[model samples]
Target chain A: MDLLEYQGKQLFARHGVPVPRGGYAATVDEAVDVADGLGYPVVVKAQVQIGGRGKAGGIKIAQDRDECRAHAEAILGMDIRGLTVRELWIEEASDIASEYYASFVFDRAAKATLAMLSTKGGMDIEAVAEEDPSAIARLHIDPLLGFQDYHARRLCFEAGVDADVVRPVSALLAKLYEAYVAEEAMLVEVNPLIIKQDRSVAALDAKVTLDDNALFRHPENAELRNPSAEDPQEQMAKERGLTYVKLDGDIGILGNGAGLVMSTLDVVAQAGGRPANFLDAGGGSKAEAITSAVEVILSDPKVKAVLFNIFGGITRCDEVARGLITAFEQIKPQVPFVVRLDGTNDQEGRQLLADANLPNVHTAATMDEAASKVVEVARA
Target chain B: MSILVDKDTRLCVSGITGREGTFHTLNNKRYGTNVVAGVTPGKEGQDVDGIPVYNTFRKAVDEHGANTAMIFVPPRFAADSILEAADAGIKLIVAITEGIPAHDELRVYTHLKRLGDVRLVGPNCPGILSPGKANVGIIPAAFFKEGNVGVVSRSGTLTYQIGNELAQRGFGNSSIVGIGGDPVPGSSFIDIIELFENDPQTELIVMSGEIGGSAEEEAAEYIAANVSKPVVGYIAGFTAPPGKTMGHAGAIVSGSQGTAAAKAEALESKGVRVGRTPTQVADIAVEILGG
Candidate 1:
């Protein structure tokens, strides 16, 4: 889960890393009030998860209350990268002597947590990497030993960070690493760590993404989720313990595994039909789970056909057939459904479906057959 | 002549008393795996399907002379289970448990690296199968037949689907391994490819990959330099959008990397026959192996 800029700053502060004092506001009045408390010359940043907020005119600096209100009023309702800015982060603007970049991410290539530091900042890291790869210094941290002071210092020297800012930057790196591990974060990025005239360094911008699988350990991070960013069907599927992703097609797909479901989607598109959604009932799915998935699929009015391509490994096809029967009875779905059952107890499952003989229900023996059948029905 | 498991493998199952553990244990035994011992803390006196249960992996190794382990433990204790298996000197460890935290996996991977002798497969995988000889993990054994094709995949059902297609077309497998669906899988495509390349019985190779990491691309490079067997490949998630986790924690595409197109391009550049469909992939395999 990606944290909003303000939330990232708050997390940084909690880890003993100094950040510019900031307040979150949802209204122009609140923004003005926050600016007054911060004593003018504040930065109003749009609170959206998407990037390029500054280039999209979602960030503005205001020297007084009038300008703060004007910036807040303009940014709060503006759409930046298709994400509407519903909130504003009013922060005290810092007087920067220089800017540098720092981040810690799990490097799949190294199989270690990598600390990346660079002298260049306040621009896209990709551009820097593409133009001058030598400017960014990456140091792999052995997860067992963790980030030591020497490791931070090595990164500072290797990245050619200014001598005056190295000590403070190294200290902040340790603190940031602590927060990253404590929160089970996938990434902890400070795009522009600013060195003020006083020689103290502070994180100016933060982009943090916590590991969603580790959310069980940190319940506090749950409050930072933005439900509006998620598809409604996906949210409903999550509530029902089903893995789903909404797509822009008419054939609703249901399967037993993520890989199988993805393959099913491809086969559907191969047959010239777009998939309405990607839904995985997961391993060991029961009738109840299948019923929930079917309901969720039908909930999308764009769906003209439904495809059930289940290759049960741990999942029993008999249970899936029962779930489809129950779902059909409950939803009374008007769309066509092409079902292909295989693996454990697939014979009994397919028999049950064949016996039902419901209208708009078809059966296929293979994935290609099922895809073509569903696409043909959807087109008809 | 199989890579990881064969008729001689002495398999020990960890967490053999749990629901998934007991089920797959029975399935493995039914498929002719020599499952000699089972491990579940505090269940030492019990036996699951005639396989004696032990409280520790050390007992399973020492008492029954077990060399390989199939893990069915839950996510919370899965890492510790891998450590236990490694510490007991198990040569090959296959983990079937899904949803193990990435941090835990990181520690597990790092710890296992120090061991240097153990080969761990999946923490969220279906396991390994040497057809008509021995089977370990959750893969249904009925779809397999003892033959000459070596198969490795990053997917569970897709592997089964393609394997079943191959089996139906008279192309049975020497061994099949699912390397799990996590970002940091215990094994990699290169690991399995190297195994197959070394195995005398594996006349052809089939690699099934999905989006997320560059394991497939790296495996393609390995095949170009090291492998002599005819390789056919199929990559899933071509239709999947970027940044969407397609059911696997490790199966998301970030930015311009880890795309199926890129992987296919890499493999094709290495002279591997890349297929768009499972059936097409099977056809390519049959054409090369002459099944």
Candidate 2:
């Protein structure tokens, strides 16, 4: 769902936002050619999903073609937050006089589109927010009215931006809002919207996060998704159409809904074990979905034990028990299994599991007991 | 009395011709919901589950005098469906569809708020219910019993689990509302809290929250300033480390403000008892209700 900086810039360009001329390079030769085409000074940036690439030495300013190639080579295989830099973006360097920040995202508190603008940009925006909370101007945009020019101008003024820069900044904000709404973006951020010495404003760095739920409407954006960027277990889960998010822990969790998975994770931790992943087989989960979910958890080498805490409703408990039994046979997991079944034919579900007579599988009458059992096994 | 939908609440189903619509409509009817009419753009004269189908929400509302609508439309058309329900003077709209674009939801939420007095429940939520009466969306009908505790949550399954736990503890819920996980939803913690605060059957409130936004903090502030009833709160994502988002589209802890600790502290500071575990939620509710 996250777009690399260059891709975000490309999307931004479509909305009439000005971005420095750039080309994505997967090899050293391509980097040199891009630098040559752009003339002498260029910025070679590592294309990774995470931020703070500059501090990590993944971004370098090159004065010549050879320097560009060397920088590109150094960044090509570099790692940022576990994401390898398989590609580099070669962009013409701009003379930045000052850096300002602007972003448009959904604000839950207001239940509306929120625009955040600040005179202080670059570096960690969180740090700036923490240090001078008042420096950032946050605006709740009415979707029906859209982000008008006047709203943008008011935000810029509130951020204490100079009067002369308001017009251009406002125009950029309007375009950014357009891209954000039209593309169904979760986040459209222009950090360090650089002010050049010539009194021109340009988006120096762009970060975009598209809403994954809206991928069905934007096939082009969906195609841009790189499955290789995701963890193998996550990729497998996605292929199976299961909602799986890996976490840092050892207890593997399987549940029927997002809320239940989250609560199960909390309970697992409360009982003295950490959940390795949050896997929701979803409502109306069948044997295949449950089997896929179990396999995905077992696939993770870090997981020490598996927990099935299902509060089945529309999905019958007996059906989930059947799936778990079927998946246990298919997976033949070495890790311990702790099951907690409740709601809708729970008696039948418990009976089926009892009849299975599988080793290393224990059924708990309560969620707490199941969580405790999983924790005990994980610790053991 | 329930907060949103009760036994007296008449309902209409949108997208009733679709498979999902037909399926849930039948389920709703079988579950004893007062489903009066169905709306599918072109399939007006037909009937789904013996409920008359109308071409639009306006026709359904006009004919059946339906006050509530449960939408099963796909994500692409969900926004328009919500707007139509709002325009047609449907007082309560519950959108059960998931995967709606955040921007589209923003538009729908903004429009619904502007319309004023019309309550919207969710775009991705399991909808609201008054136990043993009018059940909306996909929550298990058997897990609930009529009681005094009012439950509201962002997560649907948690609501079900918590409701079941309460039922096991001999504590029945007056109503349960899933405000949903979308960042830009039609209703929020404050909306439900406001309704629960005024409901007579609801003697205690169980607020379930997760990491994301300051809705909990805002609700805490409201409860602090207004509500006099006993409030038991359980916030998820405490063990969920800072900065790691969950499956909810709106789930994100960008900073310390939205952390579980901060929310728990805020709620506790407001005199609301906070439960650290899901099982502990009912215990706190029982204590609050003097059971």
Candidate 3:
């Protein structure tokens, strides 16, 4: 749910956070027009969700239309972090006097909405954090009261923002917080909130991450979700309403609950296997859900083996076994499968699977054994 | 003698007219929970599975004197349902609905905090109960039995698995609570830890936590400072790479604090036993309890 910088800036502008005048273009002609409109000394930025775009040569400053078009063409199809540059945001370059960093995200440690502010902005924040962690000022905000004007002011002052910029910066922070809450965002960051020579503060770069669960309330935001950006296997899983996250590994995992699935992943990795994906068939281990999950896992060619680790409670293992048997009929899995089914009707579940006597399917007495068997099979 | 609901504890089901509400309500009643009444707005004076249905939590509480509430309202209305139960003086509210907006949860949580005595378990959780006596939420009814161990987890399936593992090891549960996996949940690890610490029937505790919030760390600190009861901790998502949001809507670890390693380290540092697996958790509990 990460928004591109241009989209983030659009959201920032809606909240009255000033940004350098900009227009997004999807083509070289459009970029030229945009650059012409903005006049000379414009900046062209690649529209991609990932960071390190500047280092990747996705961002360039142009003094004239030719340079703008050239930069836009160079960035338009450039690949940065596996994201192809489909669009470019051309803006009037700002006269930067100083740079600051600010972001609002949920702080798991504090169990509160946290605002991070730092005087150092334009460079890599992670490097700054590693080198001089003290430079960053963090404030935990109570969700009930929200990020109030006073809180924002305190943060701005602590971030070493001068008096001339504090009022506007504080106001902008309050507005950003509002937008974040309204959009159900997980994170809202304005890195390099540039202070011009005139002491006016404006957002030079913006990044926003929205919460997917709250998308039902905001249809517009939900519509903005680009399934194309997601892994094909993950996208397919989502289409079937299964919780799935693809990882760079060979062992495919299928489990009922998040906690159990995660634990299974840990055990699998601990047993010397890499997990291909995190797939949860949810509380209902119905035949259809299991079949869907199996199909999704098999869709990934990287998956060397499949692991079904079921600790059934509300979900009956018998049902899961039926699903696995049914899915085997449908998919005819090419890789090895190691299953560890325990809990409700586990004995019956094992008996049913044993009755099938399917090749390439191995049953383990313990989770560790199951993981070990899967790893062994995947390696073989 | 359990931490929350027992055979004697009176309970009411909220939003009982809904399909999910009625479904779980019937299961709860059939499983021996003393479900005295149900609350469904505009469906008052009716009976759901022979249990009286009231228009509001106040009416249900007033008529039946129900102390515990299990909410099955839709996510959009979950916040109001929690506030209603809280306002009606229901001592314990268990919300089993998922997808509640974070803001709504925050509002409900803040309001409950202001009320100062009422306990809210979850807006997206499976309800809590004493094993083999009074059952609540969607957990399998057959897995639990009456014992001295108390179980609390952020996941429903994990609670059942942990309960089964404990039961298999000849150590049953005093009570079990599935606190759901929502970020801005009504109740937290600290709330359940206090109950498990003070409850006399609970001789040993099994805490099953997932990666996301620092609630586990906070609970570890709480256990370090207070709680003399032997605690066995089995935290999930240990192998999960950092920065990947897990299945639960509330489960996200973008920074350093929410990793499972950090949680395990914090808990282990506090002298609470940590388990790498369900069997390990059971073994740790059995070893500590000398069973």
Candidate 4:
């Protein structure tokens, strides 16, 4: 889950990392109130989960309350990179000195947490990496030994960070690492980590991405999940313990595994049909879960056809057939469904579906057949 | 001449008393695996289908002479189970449990890397099947047959899609390894590819990768420089959008990288026959090893 800029700063503050004093507001009136209290010169940052907000005019400076109100009104309702600004972070403007970049992201290949530090900041890291790769100094931390003072010092020294604030920067890196581990964050980045006119270092911007799988252990972090950013059908599927992603199509897809579901979507697209959603009922899915999956698929009014391409190994096809029967009785789905059942107990499951002979129901023996069948029916 | 598990495998199943553990333990036995012992802390005097049960993994190893371990433990304790099996000197540990936290996965990966001897296959995978010799994990054995084609994948049923397609075309597998779809899988495509390269029975390798990470791109590099076997690669998720986790934690497209097209192009650049579909991949493998 990606945290908004203000939310990331709020997390950084609790971890002993220095963040510029800021207040969040959801309304233009609240924005003016916060800007007035922060004094004359303040920066009003749009709180959306996308980057390049400054270039998109979502970020502005206010010299007075009137300017603050105007900027807030302009930014709060603006759409930057397809995400609407729902909140604002107003803070006192800082005196410029120098900028640097630091971040800790997981290196999936090495299976280790990597710390990247650079002398250049306030620029897109990807552009920096592509242009001058040598500018960024990378280090992998031994997860067991953890983040140490020596590790941070070595990072700063390797990145050629200025000598004046290396000590303070190292201290902040230690705290940031602590927060990274404690919060189970996938990434914690500070772009343009600023050094004030007094040569004091503070995190000017934060991008914290938490591990959604590890959210079960951290209640506070779990609560940080932004509800507005999630698709309604996707969120409902999640609540029902089904793995789902909403896609722009009219054919609803249901499968047993993530890989197979993705493959199903690909096959659907290859058959010249757009998948309405990707839904995995999970391994050894129960009949109740399949029933729920059906309801979730039909909940989308755009869905003209539904596909059940289940290759049961541990997941029994008989149970899936039972769920479809129950869904037909309960939800009374209006659209056609093309079902394919294979693997263990497939004969019994397919027989059950054939016997039911539900209206507009069809059966396919292969994935390609199922995809083509669903697409043909939906098109008709 | 299989890479990991074969007729010689003396298997001990951890969490053997649990529902899934007992079911798959018996299933593997039915496929002719040497199920030597079971390990479930306090379930020592019990047995599943005449296989001995022990209180500790050490007992399962020392008393029954078990060499391989199949883990069916819950997600929270799955890492500790791997450590216990490793400490007991198990050669290859196949974890069938899913949803193990990323931290625990990281710790176990670090520990196993340090050990350097043990091979941990999956915490969210469908185990290994050396056709007609030994079968471990939940892969339906009927879809596979003995042949010269070595297969490795990060998917379960999708692997079956290709495996069954090959079997239907009269092409059998030397060994099919599911490396799991987690971000940090215990073994990578490179690891399994190397195994297939060294095996005498495997004349060609088929890799099915999905969107996520640079594992496939890295594997393409390794194949280009090191592998001598004919390789065919197929990637899923060409239709998946960016930033959405497609069931697998590691299967999401990150920004612009890890796309199916990029992975396919990388493999193709390295002289691999990249297949657009499972059926097409099977046909490519047949064209290489057929009459």
Per-candidate local distance difference test = 0.90, 0.86, 0.85, 0.90
User: Candidate 4: lDDT of B282?
Assistant: 84
DockQ value of candidate 3: 0.63
Steric overlap count per candidate = 0, 1, 0, 0
Evaluate candidate 3 by giving its C-alpha RMSD to the native, one decimal. 2.2
Write down the C-alpha DockQ for each prediction. 0.73, 0.72, 0.63, 0.67
- Inter-residue clash pairs, candidate 2: B147-B172
Number of the candidate with higher TM-score, 2 or 4: 2
- TM-score of predicted structure 4, chain A: 0.96
lDDT of 2 by residue, A1-380 (tens): 88888899999999988899999888899889988998979999988877789999999999987788889889988878888888888999999888999999866676677799998988778899889999999988877888888899889989998778888888889999999988888889999898788878999999898888889998988878542276889888878888888888999999877778888888888888989998888887787778878989989999999999988877788889899889878878898899999888889999999999888998898989999999998888
The residue-level lDDT of candidate 4 at B126 comes to 96
lDDT of 3 by residue, A266-356 (tens): 8888888999999988875787889888999999999999999998876788999999999999889999899999888899999999999
Per-residue lDDT of model 1, residues A336-373, tens digit only: 99999988899999999888877789999999999999
Clash-forming residue pairs, model 3: none
- Model 1: per-residue Cα lDDT over B1-291, one tens digit each: 788888889999999999878988998998889999999999999998789999999999999999999988888888999999999989899998888888888888998888888889987999999998899998888888888999999889999899989988988889999998997898999989998998999999999999888999999899999998899999998889987889998888888889989999999998999989998999898788776
Residue A43 miss distance in model 4 (angstroms): 3.0
Looking at candidate 1 chain B, the ten consecutive residues that score lowest on lDDT are B282-291
Model 1 stretches with alpha carbons more than 4 Å out: none
Q: Candidate 2 on B35-87: residue-level lDDT in tens?
A: 99988898889997589999899999889899999989998888888889888
lDDT of 1: 0.90
Off by over 4 Å in 4: A29-40, A64-66
Residue A313 of model 3, lDDT score = 70
Q: Looking at model 3 chain A, report the run of 10 residues with the lowest lDDT sum.
A: A221-230
2 or 4, which is superior by lDDT? 4
Candidate 2, residue A357: how far the Cα is off, in Å = 1.2
Fraction of native contacts in model 4? 0.62
